[model samples]
Target: MPAPQMMGIYPSDSISEVAHSLPIDPLGPGAADLLAGDVEYRLHLILQEAKKFMIHGKRATLLPEDVEYAMEALNVEPVLVPPRPLPIPSFQPVSVSSTSSSSHQAQQVYHTPDDEIDFAAYLKQPLPAGIASSAGVKWKAHWLAVEGVQPAIPENPAPGTSRAGPSRPQPASTSLRPQARAQLPQELQLYFTRLTTALVPPTPSAPETEPERHRLAALVSLRTDVAVAGILIYVIKWLSESIQKCLMAPTGTIGQLVDAVDAVLENEGLFVEPYMHQLLPPLLSIILTVPLGPHPPSSSSSSQPSPYDVRQRAAEVLGKIAEQYGKSYPGLIPRLVSTLTKALQSPPFPSPLGAAHPPAGRYEGAVLGLAALGSQAVKSGVWGKAGEGLSKIDELAGRLYIDGGKRKNPLIRATIKALSPLITAKPADVQAPQINMNEVTNAFGPYIANGLVKKGWTANELLRLRKEEMEEGEGGGEGMDMDTPRI
Candidate 1:
């Protein structure tokens, strides 16, 4: 049986015709047949390689560039052709009558027409405008997924949905729908992804590891990047959600989130005054929420910070906000003081009817938050005169002390911390005024009096600071008086 014919055929007649046209002697039948078969085989290989290129490019139609690439890959000399606007032309069929009258049948031939250009008309036409050069290429990294869930971001292809089926409308609920993150620019989306992932890394890293470095770098970007205004709302939303999720099981992530807030506040380029209302709720929640995390075992030697430490960091961020925007929003500090004071004054006593009472952690957090507001805040919110300010605190402390002496220690420590801003030591040369313990106790109640005594504060100094704070509070504005108790 004859060998099977290949997909392509370069006839020996065509090869002979080409040889005759060239300045060479006509080839023999065998030479012409061998050349035709070899040409056909090479053409098949080139087409096969080009098809592979097309598949790799995820395209159905083979392109001229694909053919060029295939030729280079196959070690064949590539044909350099300029790119054209139109696709390759198809062949047109023509029928010709036979020259001999005996042969009545006509012969058919297929011919490809050449492209024609009018140079004179092209030269007369106006030149098109040159395209502007693009910015230089730079490398950027972003998270594709965290814990197996892909973040809805512009960098990732949108999740596929069936276009053939009718879309179902989702029911509206009280919960807010997440922001349309797809509309954000690709750069901002990537930046947000990197910052959030670094802030709360999935796998905890040692202080010296790359994740820690990345966290610090992300914070630095937050503190210094001028172009981050576009992402401010999203960052704040992520922060609020992360804080809520981690509140019950406090981790280093909470502290990192607080640090991110502080970093955002530190950025001089951003005008954070507008978002302060949204920002304060999360910070206040950190301050007032109870059971932030499981209390660490007293015997554990792990280096991780406790939930109290996270609260302290959050309080510091609150302080920064007040200090930075207090003048612009004079009511801000007052509002914070009011909220914190309510938390601090909530009765810790167990109800006779079995009603729940606020935990001691809330009181401690309120104390820290008040202390962070500065000396004036401490005096107004924590050091009220005779049954007005901190009266509830003294009662709570006394009750805790009577029930369990050691249990009261944390509250006393927190009280002292709150009063630290008001404590100013007398000069070494000046004799410290001495006061009877009984008088101090009767004047300011036993709880605060003891805390003052521990800090070496004389009764006269306490009275003097209280008087000054009252005077300042009166002169400041009506808002300041709202936090202060009536005389």
Candidate 2:
């Protein structure tokens, strides 16, 4: 079969002329045509490569560098063409002015002292670059004259109104309050994808089989980078919203998320410490109120992990975080106490779309959240304050025990266990433990005082050794007459 013809992008006539332009060459009959065909093929390849370069650079216009880069990538030497100087346009001076003005006026045409009519030279002169006239080009119909006292157009907008012409349409409000997640920026979307994947892999099959790869990676990220921690907070917020809007429970991802949070609490890194104040609210919400996972089918037996289990896990995670970081963030305890008290007191959610009170698991979660804060939270009458000395937590726990001691209610039992230490002893009898200042100072030695004075190097003996080493180094020399004692 005859070879299929190749379509040429460059004009054959131009290529042929360039081929013939070589001084010593007399044209062979098909040589010019062959060269033209080759040139066309090369040009087509260059254009294709240049298009790819343009796309990679995210530019619509194909620049000279794009072609050069394409040539370099393809191992083709490119012809360098020097840029020609721009032709300077000349201008003839024309005098223009208002003829109606009776006062003496300066000449309308401005000129340098040389008086030659050279627009380029005039432009090159060290003078301000601007239109000679005071007026700007008007693109739309503007009221040149406004109400008598209102500032004229372009200088200032009319009083109380801002348009020179009809105003542009206002964008539709994209308020995401009741329904959807807020639209994240493109960069944030990418970060969210990477972070969520790092938190909980897409196809997590078993919790115990692997070494929690994504969870470890996320903790490492939190330990080092504040920005990563912020991204995790963003993810947590988004997760809360997702749980709120979800029609049914999600898969076991919620448990994985709780595990990831627990890992962060366990890693006592600098970055995660300061962000606890911001981190606690969403975490408490997850424990006290947010849905954990998809509800089991009604036909399924009670053997399936109940919704309360997820809340309990979230509650445990909260307790761990509070036990670890709550001292640093004092406000966290009070907020948790308030939230738990409210949840415990509030009625169950009436329906899917009603004023949100709390869920069945919320009561349990509230107790757990309080327990996470330790005994002080319960002793403070977080549930309520009846009188000057009456303990509300004691009163509530007593009532629950009386109501269901034999029933073996887990939530009530947990609450009772948490509050038991605080309530068992009267406040008057439980005196604050006394500390011997001299004993503490003697046990810690001068190290504590030295650290406070010096701002570092807490171990006094180590500091003394370091100082002696430094002093010895100062006395030693590379070359010395050791035996000769001369003054």
Candidate 3:
């Protein structure tokens, strides 16, 4: 058996107050002290045992139920109260008034006081139907918005200002427009702030890892969380740089990052539509420049496979964005065309390996970007026949393909591929000549002779002579004499 534990004695005054409240006469002087001591001793024992229950349950905090169970184990009898019997009654009719006939109240009755309840029979009665034993709750899921735009639904409708409708009459003193933009929700703001910190590398040395990627995936799944959509601009720029550095990274991971960015841009309802101006520059820079990572190498090296891979990815995303939001964002197409053309014309970094390789590689990326941009570039006069720029672009593409005989170069290959679509000819639709040259020349000969007649000859006479000459020439089917008429 374990030795009993002792604890500090409780205040006697508190004990006396509890005793007086319990329908007991106030204890006299030292009697209160004795009662308090006994009660404290018992309480200390219960608590000592209750701690063992807490430990057994692997919990740090002690609860009331633990003390109750401990008391039971210690064989301490609980305070008992006998259950009161329910009353039953005998009914007697009461007087009713005719004027109260329409009242929903039931007719009055009198009950006799001597009746008693049949407790056993009441216990045996079945519970009423449709009454639940416990409360139940169900959860449902939905999207409130996509990007930063609120969607119209039963729970969250578009705001009154976003909708176009007739305004209700208001006092002339009041302005119709809302005064200021509403503040964002605290939780959503915190979520995106953390997400941006995690997803965007504050330092150049931060390594791309699985945990960060998973956080991004979770955020991406919340596409309808419009509050986070505006932060995508920063996220996208970071991803554009990430893909540039990790061109050789595992396709699956990098591809997911690409998909996430694309998904945000593609979301139809997001009101962050104006951010497209900011969104595309990073991607365009990546597509047009070589070695676009934060600390890109200044010199050309064999280690880099030129700019083909990163440019290919950026070009694809550029094409999709142009196709999707072309009309909504008119400037995107023009900017893409101009950037690509300018990059193609940019001077290469002078390198020991070869000065031409760097510029040629950049040109290749630009061409690939243009190819991905497709007919838009052509329509925008990027490669169209109208401008000096178009001719220069053609000449540049031609020189890179032919004069730069390094067939193994990615720049050369991409340039060839880009120009292929534009220069490739479909078979011309051949048709026979509509009119013969010989017949037309013969008919015009007489008119030529009449106009060239000497000054002495009358206009009428010259015309008559030319007509006679033509009739003679037509009948004979011979060629005109060159010495007879200069015409």
Candidate 4:
């Protein structure tokens, strides 16, 4: 039997037409048949590769992009075709009579019509604007939901809506306004809210009684809570703002703020070293500010401790800070001493040279602050500079005594207290040598000498301390000179 002839989807007639269009003689029967079969096989291979791409993409139908990708994968040069809708071709029928006339058949051919243009009209027409190129692919991120609540933003889908349409609106009472969620955990947020609320005092008009009980509880939490480091910044911010508000117009709240500071300082779990800069300003302001709260009415006999008492408490807090951090931050003590010295040295009244003099309350606070820094600071800041600090205090105290008398005058007591550290012997059993009163009177001036005598300090102790202070100053000056390099 003869071998079977293979069939091809491409027609020999189409191959012959292509040869004629290339300005070559129409292909012979054998050549046309061979070419048609090869072309049909290549088409099947290309289609097969394109089908794989469509399946990989999970697409039901093949696209032009898939065909391009398929051609590239098969090492064939892909056709560069602009994306457009495929035009429908019209089919026309033609009758052909064979040479024998016995065979006649109708053949159908499909061809797309060419688009005709009128050159004259086309030349007169305005040019179409060029299409802008699309932007390159980019990626961005935005929060879709936080803590199970979807945020209301353009990127997030609207609530109660879908691709179909919006659903019915819920009742006004049932719908809640979306609030911005805190970055903190839920438990921490609740704790912070409760802590701050309890710490802040109630306003005078508010009927919430027992603000003290709440404040004390809050302070205890600050002192004892172990996991409060996370909220440390928030607490510091609250303290700073509260101190500022209280400084502007002090109330019982100012005293509570001091207690809160002390409580935070006492917490061993907190690493407050980083926040010391922020903590110090408010504390210093409290210690140095005059008349922390309004003076009580003279007619009423109010038993509340005056603003001076609050200032004293502030000084104690400052002293604790200095003792704890003085070694770590070497400049802390000097800076504090400088500030208090300036306040202490200011004239009791406005000077004739128009210098700004701090109030008597500030003078008292300065003396207390210097004394709180320990004996060394007291010696250097108050009793150093050839006893100028003491002379200034004596002048201020004299004026106070004349106005309010010695019993009521706080400056007199503060000055005496500041002197105690210098005059008191370090060892209990150590005996100070006896010195003449005239030498003591001349060395320290009359007022300080008299005050020392009144405070039960002997002339010998006063002169001895003054002599030691001078000798230390001379030794420090020599040490500095010896350490200096000569050019």
* Each prediction's TM-score versus the true structure: 0.54, 0.38, 0.37, 0.53
lDDT (Cα, 0-100) at 141 in candidate 1: 65
RMSD to true structure for each model, in Å = 24.3, 21.7, 30.0, 24.1
- Could you give candidate 3's per-residue lDDT for residues 1-487 as a string of tens digits? 4333333468777877788789877676577667667888889899999999999999999997898889899998777555786555567777555557578565665765455889778656665554434446233467887897777777786587455653321111111112211344456455645654443333222236765565566546445566556445444455555555443333333334455556666555565466665557656665655433312242423333334665677678778878877788787778878877777666555543453533455676677788788755743434333223334543454444434332234553454345344432423574322333233224322222222233112223323334565577675654455434766
Residue 255 of model 1 has an lDDT of 75
For candidate 3, the clash count comes to 2
Best by TM-score: 1
Q: Lowest-lDDT window of 10 residues in candidate 1?
A: 168-177
Tell me the lDDT of candidate 4: 0.71
Tens digits of per-residue lDDT for model 1, 42-77: 998999999999999999999989999889999999
Please report the TM-score between candidate 3 and the true structure. 0.37
Error of 3 at 85 (Å): 96
lDDT of 4 by residue, 1-487 (tens): 4333548778988888878879777665478778888989999999999999999999989998999988999999966666897866775544554556665655455555667999878666654444224355334578988999889889888975754542322111211113312556767767777787777655432334577678778899999998778778777877876686566343456677788889999999998888888888887787777555544323321544566777788889899999999999999999999999897776565433333443577777887888889997887777767566666666666664445432435765676676776665546676545446567557755555555554334556656666777888999999889888752
lDDT of each: 0.73, 0.53, 0.54, 0.71
Angstrom error at residue 26, model 1: 76
Ranking by TM-score: 1, 4, 2, 3
Residue 416 accuracy (lDDT) in model 1: 65
How far out, in Å, is residue 82 in model 2? 46
Better of 3 and 4 by TM-score: 4
The number of clashing residue pairs in model 4 is: 0
In model 2, the runs with Cα more than 4 Å from the true position are 1-195, 201-204, 207-248, 273-278, 290-292, 296-305, 320-329, 347-359, 381-405, 423-487
- Give the worst 10-residue stretch by lDDT in candidate 3: 168-177
